[model samples]
Target: MPFFLRTMMKVLRVPKRTIFIVVIAFVLGSASIAYAIEPTTFHTWFNALYWVMTTMATVGYGDYFAKTVRGKIFTLFIYVFGIGLLSLVIGKIIDLLSTVYKHWEAGKLNFHGKDHIILINWSKKAQYAIEEILSFSPSSHIVVIDESDKHPVTDRQEIHFISGDPSSEEILEKAMLKQAKAVIIFADTRIDEPALADGKTLLIASSIERLHPAIHTTVEITQEKNTKNFRHVHVNDFVLSYDAVSRLAVRAALQQGSSEIINQLIRREVGDDIYEIPVRPEWKTYKDAFQGALEYGATLLSDRGDLGINRKLNDPIPEDARLFVVSDEQTYRRLLAI
Candidate 1:
């Protein structure tokens, strides 16, 4: 057996009850044999050994008896031993049952799906992001991977928590990296070396890309300078909190209802929204989709074809392109009807 198993067995092994039962069984068997051959010089110890094996194996032949006074005393002693042995056996069985139950519970929490969000670090911002994702899609499964023993998000049936260092390949594999929709690496702000934290996040992102090149990854960088180093990783999105916050503050002051508008726009699964949709062969230009959006009470934001590129809102659409449009489902359906 493995060392762990051996250790556990020693720690949780059955009690003295088992020994008592064995002794009792031996005594009873011996007594019975002694009684069967009454007046014969049959040794009690020899008869006990024979009887114990037979009884434990459930091979009673009914050829033995404990009719005499000495034999009866031996049988009484056997009963005591048997009871203790049974208790010990029962205790061991209970321990095994508990262990199996725990394993079953853990299995039920396994995550498997695409487009599902994987949050790397456990922090206030990450916690908020989780809440936002949940609010957008209540049925969406969010897996939190962190080294902390305790998770920040409250226990829920849908959320899966795996405690481990995010940078570890084993941990990432456990979180189902290849199958994940988007892996979001949150920089560990609690650490003194914020740049080192970002580096770790970058390494994790790069590892995922190398393992599964097609996988979409988004990373948060605490320092703006770190963003330049991450360019080689091909991360789909790079969110800089410092810059985004500063811009948001400026926009909120200049544009009335801009903060609320921005909040609704960024919030997933709510309000008049912009979402990516593949352009069909029939749709030739941005103008073609722009007209469709107008009819659907929506606006075409950008095209997936323009991803990783610097393009203006009014940029002409590529012939073979995918588009991002802002609209409600009713409007979306109507536009599709065109």
Candidate 2:
């Protein structure tokens, strides 16, 4: 290659924005030159542009051609330089896509979306949580943070992963924790002792609370006794893994098929899952909310943490009431619409 051509090729490898602008300018300038030099043959700007593009791309459709000697020489100039520039652009695009994919697989990319759910630590339980979240809301964005080198789930577009220590504030920020809708810190099952696992979870929970106090946070702990420790950090909810399984097993043994019913309610893949509904102006008491939900083919389950809404059917609804109902997806949508 000539010195000028080599220098031009080097310039093409600059930042993407600059290369993009240069490509645009080159296409426009080449088209204008062709149109000015061969007005009789290249009748319009579009024709000249088409010819220049085809020549650069090496497509050479042969629909348009330069009739004059000067136009032919100019076309040759474009054939040599323009084709090289176009090749560089194509190569650059491929390189960029490869770089992005590597970053994604390595969990080195940062998530900037708001209202996304963040799951710290990757485990079988976290995998199930991702599935449930997707089933509940297919379009929901989820971010996974862990110390592992590779992302656990790369097939899902909605689930993003970041590789880092969960307790580190810097890693949490990379996951965009402050803008997240909720953060679920799962216990590191690799650790054998319950106290050690809960200790790790508590550290991560405290970091999240300090970074974004208002954001809802749910944590899984091995021991139920450590639940009180989370209260100091104002963690929103706790999932007692070991105790919950044991209690559910005992309940199932006492009442046949009771565990199955609970499973259906908790998992979105099954029937009549729990859902939250907005408080309407018409609702004055638990009776009003219950009847309204029933009319929409749903049953009001509870108000906030109070599961005894059945006992307080006649009592006035509190102003800060958050009503939960049991319904399928269609019924839930109808209730939300109202």
Candidate 3:
């Protein structure tokens, strides 16, 4: 090796002894050899590097050639060794990408971002929840935790998957539960018994509470009677999945089109869905806020989960108030701007 080539390799940090480093050293050394032997044919340093690149890439443009016997021998050596080393590097890169993609699809990677919604368990209800969340906030990041071998939803970029036992703290940490906006746990319907499914959900919810007590967690249970069991855990909310369906069915039969109305309210894509809005600076009382929303074509529903805002119209609005309203997306946008 030339003194300058050795010095250049040292400056380039080629002493790491990695395959990539070795490949870089080989290419640079080959370029220097080509330039030193045939300075007339390869007039510039860039031409020597370009010739090495074309030969290693198998492009063989044939613009540069070896005129001497020694140059031809060196060219034959490159054809045998240089091309093989470049091919090895290319194959390694392809393999690395394939492994990363496989790990991602298999839910083996960790989510490093914050404020993402963490979903526990995969089911039809979870699928609908993801759809509804996306309808409301299309840019929302969702991290799904399930015990499946592969990701349930692969087509969407906003949704990520982590495969493991939901009750495992390691798995929750992998999903970045500490920085999550909220967590939704669905009953694993694959289990034969409803009690077993609820038990799984409860265990996962308890784990979440232990890991992050302040993280708002909503759980779905198959049986309404089992709600008492979760009283110990500080779960934010619970949904009786089967009981809700049965109640909705009875309501639909009793008060025609009631289920449709409820469905429309729950779904963001449907007309007049529920939305939360911040209090405007000019609003002083419930009446002021209510009338302001009415002017913007929105109906005031409640303030901070208090549904009796209609009766409390004369009362002053609380300082830490969160108002809920019913309006279309366009009307909500207009209300937000005001």
TM-score of each: 0.65, 0.88, 0.89
lDDT of 3: 0.90
lDDT of all predictions: 0.69, 0.91, 0.90
Model 1, 211-247: lDDT tens digits are: 8788778888888988877888788888996788898
Q: Mark the regions of model 3 whose C-alpha exceeds 4 Å error after superposition.
A: 1-18
Off by over 4 Å in 1: 1-115, 305-320, 333-338
Instruction: Give model 3's TM-score versus the native structure.
Output: 0.89
**Clashing pairs for predicted structure model 3, backbone only:** none
Each model's total of backbone clashes: 9, 0, 0
Report the C-alpha lDDT of model 3 over 1-338, residue by residue, as the tens digit: 69988865654453324868888999999999999999999999789999999998889999998899999999999999899778877766787799988998999999989999998989988999999999888999999999997988989977999999989999999999999999999989789899898988899999999999999999998888889888779788899887888989999999999999899998788778988999998899999999999999999999977999999898998899999999898999998887
Q: Assess the local accuracy of residue 282 in candidate 3 as a C-alpha lDDT between 0 and 100.
A: 87
Tell me, by TM-score, which candidate is best: 3
Among all windows of 10 consecutive residues in model 2, the one with the lowest summed lDDT is 8-17
Q: Which scores greater on TM-score, model 1 or model 3?
A: 3
Model 2, runs deviating above 4 Å: 1-29, 43-46
Candidate 1: minimum summed lDDT over ten consecutive residues — where?
305-314
